[model samples]
Target: MEREIVVIATSNTHKLDEIKEILSDFQFDIKSMSEVGLGGLEIIEDGSTFEENAMIKAKTVMNKTGYASIADDSGLEVDAINKAPGIYSARFAGENATDAQNNEKLLNLIANVPEDLRTGRFICAIAMVFPNGESIITRGTCEGSIGFEPTGNGGFGYDPLFIVPEYNKTFGEIPAEIKNKISHRANALNELKSSLKVYLERI
Candidate 1:
């Protein structure tokens, strides 16, 4: 059987790997937007919500590649900070802030909040667009609290500061195999997987 060609709208290699791993059960020739000769194709994510941002990228890539495209927008939302840095999680410190810098800013912002009130969650929104101009959107979230300080050096982004209450460990401290199953991105992609199977069958 021939593999279906799909495009993932992201230049980030890590995201591509995670998405590919989750969808491994299916026979898909998943390629990053950059891999499909869409390298350096910058699409502005000016949407106020994660879903809107994900759709923008997905639709852009689908229009360009004429193939099914998947895109996701994810961020950390701290309840103590009024869910701030929601869409700006990547550039919380600045346009080119590093992970460490972003973490520092978040810590300082919530430093005064009591432990019980230091709640937060990781949010992920996935958008899939097909050549037929049809689109599907889904959202997933992982509830947790921000740690007092960074821990472990495993995962990236806010992994070190986001603590899973069930395990009492940061994402950076958890194993990749486990994190891949429970992360916000993981949840969203899993939901998308189910939808994709049915959608593909109908079309």
Candidate 2:
């Protein structure tokens, strides 16, 4: 029988669905935190960096459930803002602020800045935790710029304003299939797949 693997750290359904889609090629049964009766593990993200936060969640879940687990922490880093929202992208406006509020605040802050100064990148840090308390980390980033206004309605959060240079479309405007193929999460997942291919084969 194959070993059980779970991604039971985030409450965000969007994140969960995205990860599940990415891991579809794998052989093991993949389950979210709710399916594994781990929906109540409140792993507070108090780490100072993305990698630290990802590890915190991954280790907590791995120790709690004794299963191979994965977690990710991602954010938008604005170069001209000196990475103002690098670790606080989710709560940029406030603790409970909605995506619209966060986007409004970001747009207002950079309203006077030039187009070139609006450059930013989405960064994702993925951490994997094993049953033996060992862990591995990988990172991915997608470069882009923040549009003057939100342009599309497909994705949530800052997607509407994130213009991908290569596609000439905001993340929200691109198909989910296309976005998943080139998003920061996809990049990190590819790295994770490469790093864990051998371990998975042995399991």
Candidate 3:
């Protein structure tokens, strides 16, 4: 059987691997933008929200390649900071900041806050755009709190500091199989799966 080709519009290897694993049940042949020859293209994310940013990326790749493309935008929102670092989560430290820098900035900002009040959540928005100009958007969230400091040695981005209460561990500490089941991206992808089936059928 021939597999349908779906393009994932990002260069982040970690995200690419996670998405591929989450959607592995499907028969689609997933390819990252880098694999599709658009890796050098830079799409500016000036949108005000995660959905908007996701749409921008999806649309850009779909337009450029004239292929079905999927993109996601995610970030951490801390209730203590009034949901700050929402859209700016990637560049929280600066435009060219590293993941470690961003995590450090977050820890310092909430250092004095009590453990009980360190509530936060990870938000993710995903957009899938078909060649025909039709698109589907979905969102997901993982509720948790920020730890006093970073821990563990797995996952990426803010995973080291985002605590999952039920598991009593940060995302960085959670096993990949478990994390893939409960992550914000996983939730969004779960919602996207149904829509994707319908979209593929009509194509």
Candidate 4:
């Protein structure tokens, strides 16, 4: 029989949707933070790096539920901005800033920056916390540049303005299937899957 698995520490429905889609082939049933009734744990993500944040979220959730949990911290790092908004990507504009506000602020910051200086990449760090309190960590990245303006309304966050150089298309311009295959989140999740496969094999 397959071991039961539950993803802890995130109420963001979009994150849950993507993770579920990515790991759809697994034998385990995946659930979101809300689905596990973890709406009470207000995880304070004050870490300076993605790994620290991921671990914090995962550990917090694991401590509460005693279930296998996964958490990730992802952000866009801009070359010209000195890798700024690195850990602060979500709250770049302020704690209460909306997606539009954050995007607008990012655009303005790079408004005068030419195409060559607009290089950036999305970084993701995933942390998995086992029921025994053991943990596994992995990371992945997708390089791209900031577009002149937001385009294609397919995704949330900074997806509309992020252009993948190899594909020459904004993330929001790609279909979910295609995006899920090549996104930063997908890359990180791949590492998680590899670890899962190893764990499963050992059992």
The candidate that achieves the highest TM-score relative to the unseen native structure: 1
Tell how far residue 115 is off in model 3, in angstroms.
Answer: 1.1
Model 4 RMSD in Å is 1.6
Write down the lDDT of every candidate, Cα atoms only. Answer: 0.93, 0.87, 0.92, 0.87
Poorest 10 consecutive residues by lDDT, candidate 4 = 2-11
Candidate 2 vs candidate 4: the lDDT winner is 4
Task: Report the C-alpha displacement of residue 147, candidate 4, in angstroms.
Answer: 1.2
Model 2, residue 57: distance off in Å is: 0.5
Between candidates 2 and 3, the one scoring higher on TM-score is: 3
Q: Mind giving the per-residue lDDT tens digits that candidate 3 earns over 23-133?
A: 887887999998889979999999999999999999999888887889999999999999989999999999999999999999999999999999999999999988887
TM-score of each: 0.97, 0.94, 0.94, 0.93
Better of 1 and 3 by TM-score: 1
Best by lDDT: 1
Better model by TM-score, 1 or 2?
1
Query: Candidate 3: how large is its RMSD?
Result: 1.5
What candidate 1 gets wrong by more than 4 Å, as runs, is none
Task: Give the TM-score (vs. native) of candidate 3.
Answer: 0.94
The residue-by-residue lDDT of candidate 4 on 50-133, one tens digit each, is 999999999888888888889999999999889978999998899988888889999999999999889999999999888875
Better of 1 and 4 by TM-score: 1
**Alpha-carbon error at 146 in model 4, in Å?**
0.7
